[model samples]
Target: MGQREQVATSLAAAVGEEIGALLAPVDAELLRHYPGDPATRQPVHTVYVPGDTFTAGTVRSWGDQALAALDEHAPDAASLAAVLGLAGELAEPVYARVRAKLEREPVEDLRVDFEDGYGHRPDAEEDEAAARAARLIAEADRAGTAAPYTGIRMKCLEAPVRDRGIRTLDVFLSGLMEAGGLPGGLVLTLPKVTYAEQVTAMVRLLEAFEAAHGLAPGRLGFEIQIETGQAILAADGTATVARMIRAAGGRATGLHYGTFDYSACLGVSAAYQASDHPAADHAKAIMQVAAAGTGVRVSDGSTNVLPVGPAERVHEAWRLHYGLTRRALARAYYQGWDMHPGHLPTRYAAVFAFYREGYEQAAARLARYADRAGGDVLDEPATARALAGHLLRGLDCGALDPDEVATATEGLTRADLEGFAVPRPGV
Candidate 1:
């Protein structure tokens, strides 16, 4: 067999064995909790809705509204209704309960460096030791002592690791780990990812900690913060990232677009033009080029402006956010930050719309191809050659399979595949 084919066969076996072993118990537990279809992978909409919405009277009323919304909009009306029914009981203590419950769940991703700079001192060297200590203690307390799937963005590199030299970065991060054990799928967001060296340094520290704690090497994954101009300018930027992940023993989770910092780097004027500025677009494109086909996640930076206005304006604002967000998600970026709960619904709307559109178009194209090509057919290279490339180019930004491509090309020819081209939007 060819080397490539041999390697693929071995890798498939390894993955199959690992998956069977890992998922067997998971399947059992899931079956106990869920009678059928286990139904994981629900769309996660990070709601930043107003705290007031959860007030004693408001929660019940909102629950009723949510139930109605689910009845109308949710694909799985019965399941969503159950979730909303429980959500209605969340009232006075809903905030705290929600926060705590979130902290305890196996969330796919959790970010600590909120855009508002909510959790850190303005100046790193400032006397925030006592405050830092207090913060750790509180988070530990919240651990009730159980750790959730979460990650923290520590003080900036120049920032003091601790008010006292005694509380070093390693010590602080270790404390967080001890407070609950590193979260499930935990990833540290390394802000201002300027060079490969910075990533190497963090990886080294994590290695040391893992050894000391008897943890697996490379357990901690990293999310790059593309905020600094230097990061964008690094010669061989994409190559540098690839090297860093390899050096770190394959613990790269994703790269995040840091809008404000990127804008600041470009000297962009006016807060209104921050996120969508040409500079930000350039930076995002750079990151995406590096991240393509890596299976690593990418997230756009947050919308700085909060939606706080009359209901109509609020909906309008949501529509705007939805359009922008839809563009990002449609381009295959899955996660983005939400600063307010009110924008939460917009996040969902944008993502769902984009995916729905992609699915519809792809489905229609495949159906047409199927109607033309009869029977359990073999690959008609002629027809495929005619349309495959076009269909592939037209695919939405996500995982794609050879089958999908073949399905889309059902009765085309080599000439057709050659002629088939889906020009990217705006050519």
Candidate 2:
């Protein structure tokens, strides 16, 4: 058995086995915790409505208001293209998809914000609001009108508000159970987290809640809001974001950047605070790197500019939001926060345009890669995964139809792309 080949070396195959044994623990840990992006639909954007203001119809109302703004300002594809400077090829398709998305699903992921969007109300007042929000979310779920993901962003775990935040989350989850049961897409957010211990506290809180409710151990998950400088780096100059992820104990679903909060924390003035600011980029860059293979999605923060004035002012705001959204997409941040109804139009426009603009090229590359055919740009396994992922994102966001993707990618289904895009185990 290969005597001539084996006679040249004294080393045996046992050495290879020994090496695998040495790395087995690390391999298992990475496979279990860092299995890559979940094979689920990631909403393009998350809209946060103040807890006290959220209603059963808030999702629909946002959609309607966004559509009304579109009708009033950019009434047609051509007008929208002019406002956002969409290319000639992207004009009709992107505009039509954005409008349809507004009508069909304006807000993909929604958070009833009890943090900054909601200030300190009295104890009873916050409790009532939290309960009311849960009831409304449950009703929306039952009525089949809920956003794909819906939940609350309780106040931070800082000293002054820690008990209040915990109580509010308790009331919200209890109210949801009372109304019916926890909706499938339940999301919770703990904001202004300054340390990894805060994340651990959150994990314990959820664990207790799960135990009390007789739910599965990891049935609940939440996003860690990165609103403070300390969340990115500790006083000892360590990368705290990575530590927070480990502290989450598998319940962390996302890392949501808070642009204005982070900017102010870094001493940026209100006028200069933005998602694209250098300070914001630097913080998010750290978040991106830390979350990279951890199954924790990173979402960019929002712009505060509201398109609520004259047509010209609205156009200017739209241009700003659209550009920022596009920039985030290019940087691999697939989701962001949208604060107002007016922001919806531009948020969707940017997302649709981003996906639609690159659909055909990505599809062709993926198809060629699938066939092992060489093209001008020679693709590798990692690039093939990215190309397949691009097409999948387009399909998930409704920018590209299933029929269109099937035609372009040579009969590859969503499942096929999912298989192609999944992370491979390190050998």
Candidate 3:
């Protein structure tokens, strides 16, 4: 295998083994982070809204409430400061955290996943579903208030059979973009994916939409959800996910681990506690493998269980998940979910960890490579090979940054290449 392929294979295998061992005792609740595509330069952040809660009337109500609250309280404020505070308070800590995230970092993209109609048929109650989606698109067009974040979610399909999902995706995304007036950078979130063929079907639909709309052929992008038992059970789950993305017109921009469905696939109970279990690792690893160097971001699933208790328990519980999430983010897994506002700290914590670890490790590894290269003009082939392997692994894991990677890899002679060709121990 080529270096990139080798690294991807090793990563997937290592993660699989690690998770297998970790989840042997528990039933597959171990949440694993998927490093996003190496080509993507932007930070990924997605905030989910319950689909059922954001119908036309409900969304209008939310906007109206903010306007009313501001009018009643601080009409003179440039923005809705008074309403911001009240809404901020009423808004879960998670929402406040999301807003804070906007202030603290450049969240390159945003995805709002409505809880209900996503990946399923629109209920009869959604008489104005198409109209509502069009309105959302138009609102997105205004773009004055909503952060330039991409609005995405699985929309209801009108088709009655198995093809309904993709058909729904086609109908909804077309309407959403045309009526909702999404920006050029919009991506569609495809939910409940079971195989590559399903994604391919959607890709065909997207292509047709693009042609009809006079847009670029690949403008219709996707963020896939790996939530099925068949997906998790595949021995080459990572490879399968990669194939699915490729088959889907190669327009996958992101991958999200579906915690609830994944948990159910593992036959675990439906309690909120199921999200963080080790079983989640398998699905996430598959997504990561698929994303390798493709610029497709991979996201870990959300924590379904909310910490509702004494301040101490909430703090401690959140602290643990925060640490876990930080590890994932630093390794290039940019986004995860926050079911409630309380998990905001974890999100910020992830951003801090990435920069801190990236800079520190880059400095250290570059220094070490410099010392070795400067001191030994006649370094033994075996030693050089081992060092090369070490650098390769380190760079892959974000233990070293771009400059360090360049320095460590510079001036590699043919003899050094000979040695490097020989697989190093534990590589």
Candidate 4:
């Protein structure tokens, strides 16, 4: 070979080796966990009730009660009409639609709380509660009235309550499995998580449970409630949300904000501990940043201001609930808590209105951007993804019909929309 040819060949070989090195298989332990798909069932809100009050039919009953209350309080349907931004003349139709939706599916997620909702009980009473909860779970499963997402919220694992909390969890899981098997979409909510160790310990317990019951590893996932100031920041002054998720050993599915508890931790007065408080906003923003690409869902806290009392007073409650829910939606927190049945109407209304109000403009922008037919505007991949996600979310929550979404997206199929939803490289 000529000298020039030999040098060129050697350089090409060297370049090939460099490229191969770059593409080499990553170390098993070093490879970061990527939460694939990100398209799981996302509930609009979780209805939390005390364990003693929980039953297979609890959520359905709540829906019925909510509908009856709406009819009785707003016989003229003015309250719903106002919340939905409809004219007085259109109130009846809109109220009917919301009423029908609640009747068909009253709750999307249900958390039978053994924490604050259940309060502290005697040991025998706690055991009974766990057993009752398990029977209810079986009943709900048999009756098919269980929400798509259902779980129990254990008492906090803080020093004072750790033993009772774990015992309750054990009893509940044991009774549940013996009755039948784990229910569909079962997730445990570990409330008031204040350290990474608590999460690791919880994961260890769950791992043990799976082994003892002959269940698949990772079958049980849990959500961490960032309810205290310590949960947001570790003792070292570093953000601890991601640490908590990692500690769960890939069993953490979500990080739920707790408005009142967090606010109280921050020394906010009871009256000021609200969904829209600046302190709550700061905490949620921290959670958003921490869980951005981790595949862990983020949920806002609930609005404690429920719609109750006389017909005239109920309107104000509806307004407050709707406003708070809309604020959470605007901040991109899709899931929250609903402590009362009356909050149901505004929950659906807010979600529907959010999507309906932006559908036309979002669709047009997405279409133009996809076709590269920009006019008096610029678009990027992030913008495109956001627009696509908005539509997908609307569809997921029953706010937007599949046919309408397809039409709006210029005939894009659900698969196409899913493809669009795939995060860009390094996102």
Candidate 5:
């Protein structure tokens, strides 16, 4: 070879060696961080009840209440029956399935709130509440009435409430562990988090709790509530959600939006505070961006308008809640908060409708994309992922059965469906 060609060849070989040396270890570590499949138990809604009133039977009671309301004001006999999961000649079966699912699993998640819902209870009452919560948890575990997702929401870590919050957490967790050794799928909610330091402090506190109680090191996970403006935009004008997650040291499982508090912090009028307000939407978007692919779930805030009056008025409330939920779903938020039991029917209905409406088209496209047989329409990787995610979520939520999804996607295997969320590197 000529001298110049020989030199070029040698330089290329050296560069290749250096690149391999630099990236091989990093790539291996990256594999460790690769988020596996999303959690199977993605609850469509979290129902919050005040600590004092929460009981093992609270969830089922709420389901009963929702069913009663549906029986009374679901427009007609067919609609009412549909809500009960019965098949009918109605144009849509989504609401019926949702109603039936709610009746079966009315509260997929329950948050015993010590914050706004519980307010500042006296120390004696707080202790009693904690004890009662433990009893209820134990009873639910024995009876199989416990929700798949269960937790407590402590007051914010702000100066005035920080001590109270920590004390409540200690009392509740201590009682819970003693009674039942920690119920399955437990999570804690920390509200109004405005700083990453708060998340770090909570993580350390959880570690201490685990050590003291002989629990596993990472047995507990908590969610950060993005309520105030500071949470979305730090005092120094930097985005703070990702920082907060990092501060949690991998203990952060979710980021939840708080509607009124978030909007109020932005100086919005109380009359205008809502889950769909522009400010709330912007905060949710930021949360989605920050938590994406981190295995940190994002949940939308609740609508304050509750159905609690005459039949006509209750229908209005249902309509409003359905609209707001649809908006959240369109933005890809699969989970939300439901403050009142009455919100249950609409919550599930909106979610089921969203999935049902898009099922056929999504399944067709996913099948075509999977086989690399795009006859007329080109399918991108993102589109395929979105379709797969939809089917997976539908299956998880009971909106669609495995047989339905499999048939729609032309005999796609379960493994094939799961691969959509976390695709193989080159397929």
Candidate 6:
């Protein structure tokens, strides 16, 4: 072997030590606050249904309804591709995968909405609804028919509804306890979170529940909805979103954009309010930045345009929804909201197509990067991680298969891909 080459340095060892000492605290802060992405499969979208209307059969019913819509309108791969303006090459694969996904696991993350979706109601009515939601969710979990993740979105922690929200949450959790025990996939959302103090309150609330029930400490986590402007930027002109994440004390799982509420708050006209609007993009960009490396994922909001009415009208709505979902995926917002069962077909269509279209190229890049085999493109560590993550997400969502990923990733197993994809400390 050839002798190693030596590099000369003029600086003294003490000089380097001085700089290291100065930056030690900042390095620790970054590790504590921005520790990179979690090694778990985040669902592609969250489907929200009213708490009062939800039942144990809701998940299956929604799948059947969406399948019915597919049968009625785009009955074949060619038709679905034509309706969504998907490329010819992607038609067969995307269509097959979407159908399989709907049949196997229709809903991923589901929220039994007790807030806007359910609306204000009598105390007795809301209380019963909350308890029923818990019971049904528990039954679904035992039956293996529940969504991968399921929970409720309670009312805001504002002064007007704070007590009511707490009570509803308590009733629901108690119901779950009575039914059996909390499922592993339990999730909660604290909506309209306009203050950091509310997040702290949520932390305390969960701690109290854990103490009472003898559950493990930090057993529960929640999502904070970015609705009002104050949630993103405060009166003091600082990035309030970052502060809110910190206030959660490490239990914040996500930051969901409330498209309609946020747009209305900004005074955007109803007709012009949309996920792609400049104002919406601005807010999401801030949310995106604030969540980076914090293990807090960001999700896009939904469109109110439901795919209903005649086949022609449904097709039009499908086109719009597919376009928006694809756009969000391109922007790295992997999750969004699905308001109706009819939106499910186009939702899966977009996701399947996005991953299928780019599958080969991404897989090839990853394989080459892993082997250190030079290719037409030179990928850095971050890009390699992204490529690995892309394939993993596609696999998780059924856009790609295990054999396909394994072969294209140059013999990398699922475990290998996952190991390589996770960001290294202090990177």
Task: List the candidate 4 regions with Cα displacement exceeding 4 Å.
Answer: 1-31, 34-37, 75-79, 83-96, 369-376, 424-426
What lDDT score belongs to each candidate, Candidate 1 first? Answer: 0.49, 0.91, 0.52, 0.82, 0.83, 0.92
Better of 1 and 3 by lDDT: 3
Model 1 stretches astray by more than 4 angstroms: 1-108, 114-116, 119-149, 159-180, 235-247, 360-427
Q: Compute the lDDT of residue 307 as modeled in candidate 5.
A: 92
Residue-wise lDDT of candidate 5 within 166-233, one digit each (tens)? 98899888888778688877879999999899998999899999999888898899999999898888
Candidate 3 off by > 4 Å: 1-38, 55-109, 114-127, 137-141, 155-172, 175-181, 233-239, 270-276, 307-310, 363-427
What TM-score, computed on C-alpha atoms, does each candidate reach?
Answer: 0.56, 0.97, 0.60, 0.90, 0.90, 0.97
Please tell me which predicted candidate would have the highest lDDT against the true structure.
6
Task: Estimate, for each residue in 1-427, the C-alpha lDDT of model 3 and write its tens digit.
Answer: 6666433333667899898888675542111122222322343446555444544233333334333332333333223222222223223432333343434332334455543434344554332453455456557456443434455565423244445444445555666666644465465677777777778777777788778778777776777787776654456634667677667655777778877877877788776434457677656776776665455678877765554466446545555556657656644466776655444434543444344334444334434453554442445544544444444433333334456455444544334433453432212
Model 1 compared with the native: what TM-score? 0.56
Q: How would you encode candidate 2's per-residue C-alpha lDDT over 301-380 as one tens digit per residue?
A: 99989999899999999999999999999999999999899999898888888888888899998988888887899998
Angstrom error of the Cα, residue 302, model 6: value is 0.3
What clash pairs does model 5 have? Answer: 82-96
Per-residue CA lDDT of candidate 6, range 1-427, in tens? 8999899999999999999999999999889888889889899999999988898888888899999999999989999988988899999988888888889999999999999999999999999999999989999999888899999999999999998899999999999999999998999999999999999999999999999999999889999999999998999999899999999988999999999999999999999889999999999999999999999999999999999999999999999999999999999999999999999999999998888888789889988888899899999889988988998899988889999888877788988888778998655
Give the higher-TM-score candidate: 3 or 5: 5
Model 6 residue runs over 4 Å out of place are 1-20
Residue 99, model 3: lDDT of: 41
Which ranges in model 5 have alpha carbons more than 4 Å from their true place? 1-13, 23-37, 75-92, 423-427
Using lDDT as the measure, name the better of candidate 1 and candidate 2: 2
